[model samples]
Target chain A: ADTGAMAAARTRQAQLTKPLGALGDLEDISVRLAGVFGSDRPHPHGVAVLVAAGDHGVAAGPHPVSAYPPEVTPAMVANFLADTPAGLGGAAVNAIARSVGARVYVMDAGVNADLPPHPALVRAADLGAGGRRGTSDLRTGAAMSRDEAEALILAGAALARQAVQDGTDLIVPGEMGIGNTTPAAALTARLLGQDAAAVTGRGTGVDDATLERKVAAVRAALARGGSDPADPLGVLADLGGFEIAAMLGMMLQAAALGRAVILDGFVEGSAALLGVALAPALADFLFAAGECAEVGHAAQLAHLNLKPMFRLGLRLGEGTGGVLAAPMLLAAAATLREMQTFAEAGVPGGGA
Target chain B: ADTGAMAAARTRQAQLTKPLGALGDLEDISVRLAGVFGSDRPHPHGVAVLVAAGDHGVAAGPHPVSAYPPEVTPAMVANFLADTPAGLGGAAVNAIARSVGARVYVMDAGVNADLPPHPALVRAADLGAGGRRGTSDLRTGAAMSRDEAEALILAGAALARQAVQDGTDLIVPGEMGIGNTTPAAALTARLLGQDAAAVTGRGTGVDDATLERKVAAVRAALARGGSDPADPLGVLADLGGFEIAAMLGMMLQAAALGRAVILDGFVEGSAALLGVALAPALADFLFAAGECAEVGHAAQLAHLNLKPMFRLGLRLGEGTGGVLAAPMLLAAAATLREMQTFAEAGVPGGGA
Candidate 1:
């Protein structure tokens, strides 16, 4: 974070008509935004949401995130492409993004099923139109090869760079997969050096029995090899999903380009854990859109030392949390960018 | 809360989808909406936001919330009436309400200046069309006569009842006044039986010297007596502002009509403390729009034993906090009201 920009923003915040620190996270948000973008009260120049869709072999595991069939992944992706009303997650993201004037890009980083070509879709350039057919079951072996992982990551980085070049100020990263949380928990546990039970959670809502099985799966995945935190590619290849690696790559690229990235939820956090291992300074460019309902997410956020902007009980993935925050970030930016200062408004302003 | 409605809602929640409590406060919110509107999935039938505008003599006190002059109140009120580009609490409320399909009502509970005549302004029938100029200085004595306080309460009650009759499912009560937090702080301390120092905060943004003076003024008001919590009306006459009293009436009436009310911030909370003394069950009908940016709000909320709906560090009270949450509440209600149940969606659903 640029300390000079932050200092300037803090001074500007004090000059606003409201009390010092009265806007709460909004005040911090504007200040951090200033630091990240190197401008006092930095608003998004343009907004884009990247939804990374993939598949996980863990859906075939004993306990899946939900009872929905694995086909739901491709079905929801198709619906998102058509802007159809799917209750899973895509519809909410589409509606919220439209409401906030954000462009939506659905990427098939890796999916087991074929998704029809759409203008909004991003696919493997070398592998042709269809997405890389995601990762295999983590319970058996590495989800992907190191080469495939690197390729998918570079693809994500390319997308992030493109968005920044197109004058996109903020990047919202989300994920959609049948049993993605399984690898997410395993990855979080590996990176944080914690027990699987602490990191595992009911993904779409499960009973105690399914939750137990899910934890056991994470424990099983850890017992497998190539789970070392020091080796970023090893972690991605061994246990992480293609969508996670891709989004992680995007986060790193966004940070490198000095573009602010607002996180979606636990899946994003899981990717971020790997992103942090790869680049510790990535934390400076990130903001939590909202608190995730997933239990491990709070721990993940704490590990990252990030304060989420709001706690809306939003467990939905697909950048919906980030979409909810676009208006607020704009409002925070507007407070400094548009609104008159106390002196400007001729309102008596006093502060400590 | 209606125990039967809550019970029914809880049972429905278990069967609908998600985990035992995956939705967090959203689960509680749905259940409470059930209690208020008497349905398992009580979505808002309609929405109305009442912005109560008033003036205070405390603006001229030793410590002012801001350096802005008193004339800014009526000037901004006129700006709000004209839908001008003043970025105070009113414009934020207007934009947020327009974003959602919520109707907005600007009422002149009391402003000291001669507010211009506007079609949207609500004034006492007896006081005629131009609107009521507000109370005397609280530094010397009562802000308004007991009769006027009662009249203001009745006026607020009438507005709430009218909104409910007009098919308004949710009521958002917000207030605007310079140095209003001073009286709000005094009323909170009086009702919660706390010290002035504990309850006082810098309203609209005041310097340390002004904050100290504000605290001393609150202490002096307490010393003037008539602050017994048991006598809610006496407390109102001694410490509360006109907008606070009116909002209190509105809350009480809304509760009586089995309607849900979302509170703005500290001013609303202060009014609610007295309302709780009048009718303890009013807590069930109320949802905090956001955590007030004011320091004294936590104590008031704790005293009421009500968890706020959201925490946006929103100290600007023009129903803006509630406006931000309108979308969330609708989404929560829609989740149960519109989405297919797990069994219906052909998904696995289990809860303990």
Candidate 2:
């Protein structure tokens, strides 16, 4: 597609009756989309969020820094459904989605335990509904087979397409997999061409010693996979979790369907990198919501050449950052769609 | 006056299921008020914003790096009413007032220009409506007479009382004086028990040489006025703007009326120090919105021992910071007012 549409959108966005570039990177996203779609008015509709829940295998080993056993993943998932007080569950997401009018769906991509029949949980797993009891043995073998990776991607695309058919126009990809940051780190290393140490940090506030171990584990996994940075699918099959692969597919499908996708924190950024790798054109549909304060997030964003709208030092990874950033997105969209242009409002533009 | 009420409020705020202290200082303010007023459910209904517009006499002299010619103050005030496309006019306070649903009133305490009649402008001057054009030889003479200082305070208090009668539950004191940062720095130095050099900083990004001159000018003014740190009223008469005096009165009246006040950035914080100096009890009603990033805001916040809710590096000094913070206040209030207790919700409070 010609970049004229995006350029026009940029012009329209700039002509809004506010300080130029004061709304921050949100203005950038809105204008870029305007140009991409060749529409002065770009409406964000059909908003959907994908929450991927999984566990880490390394937690089975004794670690002084690791808090809570891997069993907490399923328990938290149940809390999300039951609305338990103890759970850091989906309440924040539920409240934010309601506030911004977004539909949310939870995907059990690789949770160790079988999720009982629930309305919120969609069985979108690719590895035959169940995986190993704990985290994937990434050091020795593939996280999931190529077939499993393909299934997950297809399921995510199908879900996104269904959302579009159901009158949804925007997709926000979120993840809920424990120890998922490990895969995210490895993905960042491969995509950004950085060492594992550069991309690895204390996940969930690990101490210095445990951080070293986590970095070593990620380095070992990268070596075991013999991953090719140029081949995105091979990287996913080897190092990316079901959730990351699914998110990447959802992003690509959203772009194909001409829907906007609000990319969440580091894990979602990893998925976006993969999506851009698959179809470089899909990058236009994605908006970097905010920079995750996680050590690897900057590396991932730099790799993709994307800037986030806000910088509140957010590192929580349950799509919370995306939801927090929704207000800015709404403000940008409102500015593009509602604010009067200079020509229409009769406000003089800079020396035309 | 018992601290237990404040303690109970803090406990209630902490138990509301959000991250511990994530809401920051606003939570502290709400909890402290719950104790002061002896009510678990405190009301924030009486709100008033005082914008004091003034000019600095020192700016008329040879200054090396001042972007604005002192005449810009009145011109900008007029621009504020003109509805310019650049948004360079009208105080940011106007937009903030609209955002937070607060009643805004502009007071011309001491502008160098002869003002015309405007519906929004309240001509409550310290030395009568049309006194000497700006301060008289402040480097040699007194900044304002004690009577004028008292009148400014009365004007602020009178506005507060009117708002209270009109059913306002909270008051937000704001200012809009150009070159007022000079007086604010002197006031901060006195209250913080620091030297003028320690508290003084470059206002509006002045160069190092100009900053040194500004610091020297403030020191000369302090020495000339014999400004007493022990007596806030004496300091106000010698080295304060009409707006700061007005804010001091407004804060005292709000405390007397049992209403809460959301203080703005550095300028407002300087006024708050004066208010607290006049009547220590007034501190109970004053909530420091946050430390302003502009020159001497940190010193003022430190003097008050107050913490603001958000730190966005804001220094736009038109009550914008305080207005932006109103949403957080609403959030804190809503969390306390709407959230159900464990007993009411039939949920276990970690005892299970």
Candidate 3:
């Protein structure tokens, strides 16, 4: 983040035709956007939504942590590209992305099944080699090798770099992996030194029995994985899914490229925890999109010291919250760039 | 609200490719929209922003409750129509309205000065007869005659009816009257049966002294006006600004025409209180855009049982919050009308 641009944006905000700080989070958002773009007048033109899909091992076994079957992962990946009358894909993310004029890029980070070729689908081959099709069960042992986690993160960074080069100004990192929220809970609990029960939540609206299974799975994963809070990469390898690692990578890379990143919900917030742990400066480039229905999302955002922008009770990931918040960013930037100054408008008495 | 359409929309939401009730307030909003449109797939096309500009006599006296002078009302009204490089008016409301593809209609509900003819400005002549240039000081006596209050509201309804006939699906009622928050706080306190000090806030970032004066003014107004909580029209005539009364009329008329009305902030919420008081069912067509910086806004929203869609800490009214929230309605409708159902996508397990 450029401090000079940020300071300049703040000064500009104070001069706009309203009271100082009257716009609240919007004023702060505009300054943050100015810092990211390194311009006092930042008008972001393109919003890119990256939905990383993978299959979670815990979702495949008996007493699965997820409400939906594991095959729903690949099915939803295909659904992300399926044509609809709305001129977008058939899923929630696609419809929302269309609403925000954002392009959806679905990545097969580590789906259990081979996803068919599609224009909107970013193939696993586009990512580096030695990527696992899916992770091992986190409840029993390490979800994946440390090498695999690193590869997925690098792959995600590569995708974000390409997006920035393609004129995308804002990146919304979303994830779709059945039973992945269990891993996310384990990772958040381990990193934050909290109990599994404290962070674990019902994924996909599971029954009480299934929710208990999820909490138990997270506790088991933390006890067996030998993950360390000081080592984010190791923790990710032990408890994070491929999509989670990819999202972390995307956030780090997008921030490095000076583009703004919006975190979807709990799963994405877990990835953000890892990213922030590795690079504390990453917090400067990220925005928490919503205080989702997930029981642990608020806790994770609180840990990151990032205020959730909207509290729409959204629990569905795949960048739904981020896409919904894109226009707010546009509106904030427009306020800074377009609105006349108090002096320019000849309005008086802004003692603030 | 159409119970049949709402029920059908609820069913459709459950069948969508995500968990039932995952969308939170968004799901509820879509259902409400369905009830208003009488369609399971309700898609609102046009968003019309109505900004009622007026003056306040309380702002002219010594120890004014407002930070800005009364003249700033007409100045900001002109700013609302000033051309900018963004191809919209050079104000926060216009810039935001442009970003959301909403049209801004500035109505001179009762401006102290004669606003020149402009395409964007809706002259007072268009409203109705018996309109006052501004209101008497609420601190001393009734704000306006009963006839004036009734005329302003009826004129507001006429403007709303015109907007709806012109293809507006959503109405955003905004207000721009200097020292207006004083009246709004008084009305909210009177209607909610709360004390003035509890609801009075620093409107436009007032200093400590100005805030004290604002609270004293509200208390004085309530004591002298003798406004009945039961008679909303009488309450308006005694304590409401012209802009606030007009907004009340606009909301009532818009809801009657089956269009969704998004309340801007403190001033608009005060108007909504009156509208809902007159027609309790009008709550079905209303959406609180944000929990604004105003202290009384939450109390007003709580009384209406309308959960705000966003909380950006906005204090500047003129439909900024409402315009910002229009996209959320569009996205909510898109989710209902565009997304594929689980049966259509061949996905399973929505036990919710």
Candidate 4:
């Protein structure tokens, strides 16, 4: 948490062979990471990706134009692990992770159906006591209890620490929650002090009419929960999904362990908003990988004053954007660590 | 040239792992090279960087905000090769060339000073001459004679062929002409079918009042040459530098030899415009490396329909931007060579 460490890391980064600030934001991230770890030679290892999956209760009612049935969450999660045909899970993430040497793990924070036990699936649900198949209706009900939110956070943090303790130096937290954009929108609206309509956007490609319905559904949920701006966490508990809660926890825990965390798109950005509010110091440890083209994401990032690493107009969740951005992160880290310094190269300085 | 060969190369590029268009403009360059060479595995070798040095006659008079005296051109070229205290030439270029595994060649196209004989210095004075020096009067003056322009082009092409025969697969042409911006502006105006005011800008930080004078100088040159927008080569001969002429020839020769050419910023972009104009087929061989902040650069690029490799707000004219961009080119080539295809990775297709 010492600011001096961050400053020192920045100094070391500037000293690298190349023009000052030539590498752009990557240089800033590398320096900050080095400072947090208090090492000039900060080796990024034990890189793992956390993909949290959950189903949104808002998706239960077919408003029309919603991509598929709510049951798709479990189906896709299964496909993600087994590499099945119906799944959007594998491939992109697999290639990107393999390229950057990051192990991928899927966390079942909340799903509609009972998932079969699998090694790749980590059960980290946050259903309150007397919890049934799902929590009370999030549309007109509380999304998750405070204790449940804390549990999700703890689970994410624990997983990150375990990865670090197991020799992972970098962690990319991603999510695959169906219709979770509703919760992300609600959370973004509350945190950024904007109306639900201002931050609400279509999830999984809905028509204008369905988009209006989704917006109304979010508004109804916000009104049902009293949408108190003072209690931002309450707003999240009232509308946040299991995966987002998990991401919030994961980011905080990763930062607490001094590992670099790459935040992906809107869902991840919402989680970052929460993480930043909870522990302001974690903001220094977080890197905005890329922004989603979703309406609410830009507002969330603007609230954080964060610039995305890349902008390829990607909207697919499940950490695909984060995975794609990993190569750039690797390049930045490598350049920072390996590039010869101007002093080392004997280039004339401003002093000359 | 067989269009089918280019198409095949594009197909091969698309087949390389990563996203189909994730590599952006780089994919196009590599594929074009592959098509030109008629080889699936086109290995770039015998890469040469031509650093053309010249003195602008216009800089001899008092100009507002000139960085150094006009004599600095030859002196800098000398310092570029020699390891003097004030020298920036040798080290930066050497470091970049070493980084990309390319060879560096300095060409004394039209330096104002008499020089000691050196192997690195190609004494092609007639081919490297600058426009009328020391005066803003460009009405009756020509930057280079028709014979000089032809000789420079021939020399450049010869140099490129020699490099290609020496096993180089790429060539980056650089320039070091002081006050060359005057001529560069005139060439840009002619190529883009715009008046000099549309393309003229503060080169190397000329003040507001002085920039007005520079614009006037460019307009005078354009009028004096009676520059025809349809005739780009004639415009270059009338108002271009020896380095620009040589670059045009080098690019044409590189294209003829089936080697890829990486165009630098505005100065090189001007050269590329001339090259493509001289041999329309050469347009297929050049890659614009970066979008410069120069006044006429974007217009010229738009005229050529070329997208720069990067946008770092660089305007340093000593081939630094081109050198910096080499890494991206190499990265693109490596990606094409190493990325796994969807079939190879056992990933599903988008049902194309």
Which numbered prediction scores highest in TM-score against the true structure?
3
Top DockQ prediction, candidate number: 3
Write the candidate numbers in order of decreasing DockQ: 3, 1, 2, 4
Query: Per-residue CA lDDT of candidate 3, range A1-352, in tens?
Result: 9999999999999889987888889999999999988998998888999999988888887788988898889889888988877875888888778766898888999998877888778865577835567889988889989998988999899889888988898999998999989999999999998999999998688899999999999989988857889999999999999999899989999999889998889999999999999999999999878899888888899988988789998999999999999899989998988999988887776544
Q: Once superposed on the true structure, which residue ranges of model 4 sit more than 4 Å away at CA?
A: A1-53, A64-90, A93-137, A158-172, A202-204, A226-232, A257-260, A289-291, A308-311, A317-352, B1-141, B145-183, B202-210, B242-264, B279-291, B306-352
Q: What is the TM-score of chain B alone in each candidate?
A: 0.93, 0.88, 0.98, 0.88
C-alpha DockQ of every model: 0.25, 0.10, 0.75, 0.10
* Candidates sorted on TM-score, descending: 3, 1, 2, 4
On lDDT, who's better, 1 or 3? 3
Clashing residue pairs for model 1: A347-B67, A347-B68, A348-B66, A348-B67, A348-B68, A349-B67, A350-B206, A350-B207, A351-B207
Error of 3 at A249 (Å): 2.0
The better candidate by lDDT, 1 or 2, is 1
Q: How high a TM-score does candidate 3 get?
A: 0.97
lDDT of each residue in A124-167, candidate 2, tens digit only:
75424344344466766677777777777877787778777878
TM-score of each predicted structure versus truth: 0.80, 0.72, 0.97, 0.70
Cα lDDT of all candidates, in order? 0.75, 0.65, 0.88, 0.66
lDDT of 2 at A319: 71
Error of 2 at B294 (Å): 2.6
lDDT of 1: 0.75
TM-score of chain A of each: 0.93, 0.89, 0.97, 0.90
State the weakest 10-residue window (summed lDDT) of model 3 chain B: B123-132
Clashes of each: 9, 22, 0, 13
| Highest-scoring model, lDDT | 3
Q: Is candidate 1 or candidate 4 better by TM-score?
A: 1
Task: List iRMS (one decimal) for every candidate.
Answer: 4.9, 7.4, 1.3, 8.2
